[model samples]
Target: MHNATSRELNVDVAIIGAGPAGLTAGYLLTKAGKSVAIIEKDETYVGGISRTVEHEGYRFDIGGHRFFSKSAAVVDLWNEILPDDFIQRPRMSRIYYEGKFYSYPLRAFEALSNLGILRSTACMASYLWYKAFPIKTVKSFEDWTTNQFGQKLYSIFFKTYTEKVWGMPCDEMSADWAAQRIKGLSLWSAVTDGLKRSLGLNKKPNDGMETKTLLETFRYPRQGPGMMWEAARDKIVATGKGQVIMGYGLEQLAADGEGGWRMSATNKDGDKVVVKAGHAISSAPMRELGARLHPLPETSWNGSNLKYRDFLTVALMVEGEDLFPDNWIYIHDSKVQVGRVQNFRSWSPEMIPDEKMACVGLEYFCFEGDGLWDMADADLVDLATTEMKTLGLLDPAKVKGGAVVRQEKAYPVYDEDYAANVAAMRGELEHKYQTLHLVGRNGMHRYNNQDHAMMTAMLTVENILAGERVYDIWCVNEDAEYHEAGDEGAEKALPAREQVSEDQAAALNSMRDVPERIVEADADETAADRRVA
Candidate 1:
């Protein structure tokens, strides 16, 4: 029924999906005096999964986003964009299993007590046995995790929650995901850290080596991550970038024959907006982007084959002043459909307007159009309430109200052939469309953090401005070039890694050497170039 006359607009760049990556690219390009248009499918919200949802006076995150990054550029950009809204939040999370909460990072005594002496002894024995005779070829997540944390600990701590998140058996999932997410962490390190914690040695390890997951604190927007995105959106528009057109669902994208692109998008009010641009950056899911391209590229098949896991958050507003202190809890209980529970109050006290009430988000990972996804909002809320009550987390009767937000393509699944499929798609896209670039999680079919998504966008803009691939966007992963340069030097310097523990050094020895980053930048010349451009 979208019958309204199509309005056309021309710009230097057209970006699909006004997410973290798209907005970052738009903001930087606009700052550099490039005209840009960003189209977002969501009628509301600027951040994709990172956006904060508000109901009544309560605010919650989709999946909790910790503003922690290894990249100095990303951290600097965040500070520049939203300087005042950030709050230092103490990291607290637990694994809820068998009607007990086990501290994550495994509080030694707590974990030992929970598992009991016999089980603890057995776990240790299993770990030593696995270490002595480790799996030679680690093909699956189960294999890799068992090698690191032992089969016993992997089954107890990692298997259930991971299965719930991916909706797949651990053995069937790709080992790359485990390596990426939980790299540099092992049972030995956790036990040492736990021992230190129990001894009240709460300072960072003297060796200065720690896993990403073991970070003790993180930054979060006082209101939510949406505040940062909203600020970015405002700055982009203020600098004369094209207005961020929300509710614009791209229907088709085609080459306009003049080394440019023509895009047709549908709005909520049954209106179509046609945009023509010299360059295009997309944060849209690879699958959706494939479907929208006329005479689809060879990459479309790979994109179609790439899988995604959807997510939904059921925010249950309860009548309680004080709830659990953890920012979130992983539900390792196989009986419950909810994979995790977020304590919004702990994230930021400002989230809950009333001191008498607390809001918790019950996160369920599901496939789009599945039974859980298809369930009515009320039914989902009831289910969440019942599950929470069953877990003895909270009383079902105390749940006063609820809100549901379903996110599609929430996680790009890492299956057996995902790497090959993504490689094929990337190669084809890079070769076929010189100006068409993909960034962000779903955009690249890479499960990355918001900062990584922003890094991709930042590099993409750099390429667009240079009219060449100046920076390789694919290198922004776990072992990517992470600069520890201070605020002023972040743009220029590439620093060395901090002194590492022996264990960390051993871990690094197994991987290939990190290539030196070579970016020659004459600051004075660049300043002059900015003015000349």
Candidate 2:
């Protein structure tokens, strides 16, 4: 592969990573007439975690994500990209807790009544009992939920699932995750609201704030979330001032004394090019960016400080199967070790091949080298089949071909000491260069959902357009206490000199093409010859 041109091209912005964040930034900036280029290392289409995998006409999203953010800007962006594609569909999800299926959002009365009136009354009594005497210490996410809802309810509805997600004991995990996820929800609120409606009580909050039901109906793309980003990519590229360069891996970054940085990249096509950017906003993980920049100081803190967890999903092309009703299921049984399972067709019928068939993405979350990641492919299928059957999900026999996708650095883990170390590195990078800005989950070291990620990208680009020295990537999500409303008016803060100089903005753009480093240095589970448990 040869260089398209020996021209030393320079632009106002260069976005790293093509996920929702990077794509959203590119879309907004390009539309604003800022010349932009999105650099992605993967050979596949960009969506990052929200990306869709297409095999034999069957589509599988890396994780089960639906459109449900309260952010107006995010919603507006969604509408702008796929206005017609927004399908207001009902969500049918249940929790298989303690071998019983409980309606998610924990329909208090129904769940209690089903457990028998005695237990139902006890549940209500205990719930009221706990609320009357709230726990003073809100330790972990589990503690916060239990204190609010009661221990029994917490154990049943939240404990297992939360443990599966963070891979930590409920008591050990942070309450912040719970607050961001489930703090405002309550049985009392749901009951009073439902009873008022059942018995003609007070009017409800707007359709969005109906707490009893988290999302009675939600939005989804006809294809997958990728459908929205792909469209944005096309529009951005069509602008003629911007281009999304796929498979262009970042190799190194060399900064000129004048504040501009040069990026050397080796793309998938094996072509090498230097991207001279006026400003660079990266949506990839920050640790990876740190490693990619050569001139490896004989010492670095990123070695084991940051860890990447890989995601494995097997898209089962069943023999005309209707495996599960929910769009997804959380797996918490220790015996199985699978994090969650998704019913892709539940999001849309288009995810499957034929009208009569079904597609299930069995998700197994594992670190780089746990024994499970070292298994054979056939064993993996067998394990998945057995586990699904054990959990009463999949019948051991009705399966067909299995398509596996293993992703590394999927989730950024917040361990005991990660927060301080990540901040230290980011602090150094902030004063070190003008061209680089880390935006997405990995980049900012924040556990942001897809909407948050997208908003980060949008904000970064907004900074470029406004010529403002805006909030850094880390502050977008982690800085504020996130209410369910999402990061709405996050940019009110301003200093006397908030605008970036023209040369400062241009200096910021040239960090593209430097080989983006892959951090945590985990082994590639997908490449292993062995596949299953």
- Give the best candidate by lDDT: 1
- Model 1: per-residue lDDT, tens digit, 102-147? 8664443456558877988788788887788777656567877888
Q: Supply candidate 2's per-residue lDDT for 454.
A: 75
Clashes in model 1: which pairs? none
- Compute each candidate's TM-score over C-alphas: 0.82, 0.76
lDDT of 2 at 66: 73
What number of clashing residue pairs does each candidate have, in the order they appear?
0, 28
Report every candidate's CA lDDT: 0.78, 0.67
lDDT of 2: 0.67
Model 2 Cα lDDT, one tens digit per residue, 66-116? 776545667777888888977766677666644566655455655654666
Off by over 4 Å in 1: 1-3, 107-110, 118-140, 143-152, 174-214, 478-533
